[model samples]
Target: MAKAPVAGGYYPPVGFHFKVEFVGIGNDNDIRFQSVAGLTVEYDTESFKEGGENRFEHKLPLRTKYPDLSLKRGMLTDSKVIKWCLDALQNREFKPAQINVILLNEEHQPLKTWNVYNAWPKKWSVSDLNAQDNSIVIETLELSYNYFTVN
Candidate 1:
């Protein structure tokens, strides 16, 4: 019997290819984004020093802070995300939405997923347009979320 060659070590997935999904929001069916950024999680540490402690410091976890998430994409004609931000500004009604960021492998399969909970748009900005530059108009949406989990 002939022996087949063994496969080498595994390669890490690329970071550029990913998908974002918006859930628990009305009129979010057409919310296709180009890029998602600002996925960060951090913790605050508290240091305590005892009266008779030799030279060691006690470090404790104080609180966890999740930074605001930002999404960027080309400006669409419908502009559902812009509308949502306007609704929150004008009507003062902020609706929580679940945002999922999925990283896909080369075969287009989901490799990792991050679920953001209770997210609402905090700010929105549009890119500047210039006739000299031939670039598509891009829009950025910043979101403030309570917490997020990785799966």
Candidate 2:
């Protein structure tokens, strides 16, 4: 007999149930972000002409490049995360911090994790205020990192 197809796990974890943590900074609520983007690694390539080949040029990877990680959440009046970002952006006091983006299951257990290294805030901005439409003031934090490891 074959086992059941539906098991105790989900095929793909839900994106909305993830958490982002700025290591060694900020309180618990600072980890709650509406969205995390720019978890990307791209290998820069260079091409050169082959000595004898007529139709094709060989390409080689030069280096790996990572784009700035973007994090968005509801604006909070009191937040340590904001202080860190402000210190770097406003005061020019730069400090690197580790960042973790964890994908969670229904039970809140970590399904997968992306550990960002040497992360520092590159930009920060808040959504516009409007009297006509009601919406949460969203704050966005953009971070530049050296690299990331998945686990």
Q: How do all models score by TM-score?
A: 0.84, 0.92
Over the stretch 26-46, how does candidate 2's per-residue lDDT look in tens digits?
Answer: 898998999999999999999
Q: Residue-pair clashes per candidate, as listed?
A: 0, 0
The residue ranges of model 1 lying beyond 4 angstroms of the native Cα positions read 1-8, 26-32, 54-56
Q: lDDT per residue, candidate 1, 61-151, as tens digits?
A: 9899998898888877675657777788678889878888889887778899999999998988889989999999988889999999899
Please give the distance, in angstroms, between residue 20's alpha carbon in candidate 1 and its true position after superposition.
0.5
Best-performing candidate as measured by lDDT: 2
**Total clashing pairs in model 2:** 0
- In terms of TM-score, which candidate is strongest? 2
